[model samples]
Target chain A: MDIKEFVAQSIGQWRSQRSAHHLAFGHFEAIRSEIAIEVVADHDPAVIELCKAHDIDPGSAVAPFRMRWEGQSDWDEEEEVKGTCILVPVPDPGQANRGKLLRDRGYAETMAAAGDYYLTADGTFVLTTAYDRAAAEEKIWFINPNVRCRVSLIKTSAGSGVVTASFSSEIRQEIRQEIRQAS
Target chain B: MDIKEFVAQSIGQWRSQRSAHHLAFGHFEAIRSEIAIEVVADHDPAVIELCKAHDIDPGSAVAPFRMRWEGQSDWDEEEEVKGTCILVPVPDPGQANRGKLLRDRGYAETMAAAGDYYLTADGTFVLTTAYDRAAAEEKIWFINPNVRCRVSLIKTSAGSGVVTASFSSEIRQEIRQEIRQAS
Candidate 1:
């Protein structure tokens, strides 16, 4: 599918179960989360504000997304971690599946991030982001229209030019309605 | 280039510089390393041993590799970190650029890893591995015959199914001779 259609299809509720691996510490964890993705109109106030914050032209953005995640991890049993982000995809003229992914909050909440997104010929969605001191790349693909899978790679470093830790995750996703109604 | 050509071309000493980004911890570090890749003959003792260890017939392995890495990082200043591993690629019958990657020492040395390797239509080399508690996927491609780049994603999980950390890295490589002579 083309980039536009792919983005449009992603507007829905998804429940995901992910298995994460911490390479440096030799540990693993199971995580479950629910994600809600909604499309924001180009002229919406939030989109406008995001564009202004990132110095992006509102007209150039093909799609703006508001994503919310609510989940609990094994490490923190009592609290459900929650986060929300606005993602804006700006135009990339010459490349297929290549564009800017602008986010309201990056690796750290205090910073904004502008990253790259690409859709491969085989329908794999790749997103890469670089922060002041951190960077990440995530790849997502659909096993079917209702089932999605993701792989993420994250790294952190100390000031003295050494990698302090590395982590990776494998996530499986299904439509929330299908999962709920089946049960 | 075809898979055979690609593998043959990779025989050389390489100097690499990598920037690792940690997502959850919000840090970045620079790492420098040198690698030497040599082809292991089909009848080599190491290849034979690896095939025996992995329970594969020696004749099925397309190529066996001996790779050594020597590097230093910020976390440890005085001592150099070093490792060596044997990578054996078994025949892939049905898919193009797809095969099994059998490694003597994976991620942390505690587990042996059997992974999949695929060469994309665009010539990107992709490797994916799953251990009992950790998983990783890495992509490598050559900008030209002499310049190569790689991106890696590693994840570790606990038995209870929670992901504690994620790590990602971007590495650039050049022929060791050129790098050394220029320096």
Candidate 2:
């Protein structure tokens, strides 16, 4: 699938179980989270603002979407982790499988970041983002329509060392209201 | 499961489909291979040689095994790709989930190499090896007893840039002789 189709297939509620290794601290953490991905209209205010922030034409964006997640980690049970981010994909005019991705919230850090994304021959999405304090590389692939897997790495700012590595398996959970409405 | 149990459960035959992205070359390759993993006794010559090469006592090694693979890649259909490697795991006395792995053939380069290995809390095997020209990081986890997935990255010698990234899905193919013997 291409970028647009990948984003389309990813719209839904998902339950993700993640296992992470913090190499720098020699610690391992497990987390369970609920994630929601939804498409945002091209003319949405958020989309326009994100485009402005990145100095891109909102009209050039394709398959813009937002992702939100809430979860608990074993490292800190009392603390609930959550965030929301808008993602805007701007495909390369010359290359069909590669493009730049604008993110309002970065993966390795909580900042606006732009990353390079490309799809492998098997349709796995590979993304690499560089932040102020660190760089991150992530790969996401679907095992089936309802199941997917993600692996991510958080590296040092210079990208010489990996501080954290994680693997997550996400299973789609159909929204009850949507099912009811469809029925 | 601990390292020993993981190795035990991995015995048998497997069919693997791999997709790799060579970043430096900007090329994608697909490979189909049949893998066979078999247990090697502590006294086996190959196991002993591998342990000796790493300056480790053969008696200290746990669950030494041999892996053999034969495959063809899309990039070169006529050039058959195959290799055999013997792996010896020397577990840390203090940590049950971490150890040093000695391999007769390295992943990124075909040279004897030693790597650090650890199992995440969820039983994902992670390994990092430093080679002469590149470094490699690999993670392997089982979705179930019959299926497993592996992701690997080959990076620059200093590990700043990823030169190649690959993901492989393997399905267990029980040998007919093994089934007959069990029955």
The interface root-mean-square deviations, each candidate in sequence, come to: 13.3, 18.8
The docking quality of candidate 2, as DockQ, is: 0.03
Candidate that would win on lDDT: 2
Can you write out model 2's per-residue Cα lDDT over A1-183, one digit (the tens) per residue?
799989998999997666665533324566778999999998999889988998898888899999999999878999998999999998887677789999888877778899999887657788999888888888787755765668877766787555566666665765323323443
Instruction: Give candidate 1 misplaced runs (Cα > 4 Å).
Output: A107-110, A157-183, B1-40, B43-61, B64-117, B121-183
Which clashing pairs does model 2 show? none
lDDT of 2 by residue, B1-183 (tens): 789988988888997666665533334566778999999898999888888887888888999999999998878999998999999999988778899999999888889999999887657788999999999988787655765668887767877555566666665765323323443
Off by over 4 Å in 2: A1-183, B174-183
lDDT of 2: 0.78
lDDT of 1 by residue, B1-183 (tens): 455666787777776555444323323444557778889888988888888988899888876888888987555568786888888888587654788888888853456788888887767787877777566767676544655556555544322222222222222244333434443
List, residue by residue over A40-135, the lDDT tens digit for candidate 1. 888988778877887878888877888888887666778886888888888587665788888887643357788888888778787877666666
Docking class of 2: incorrect
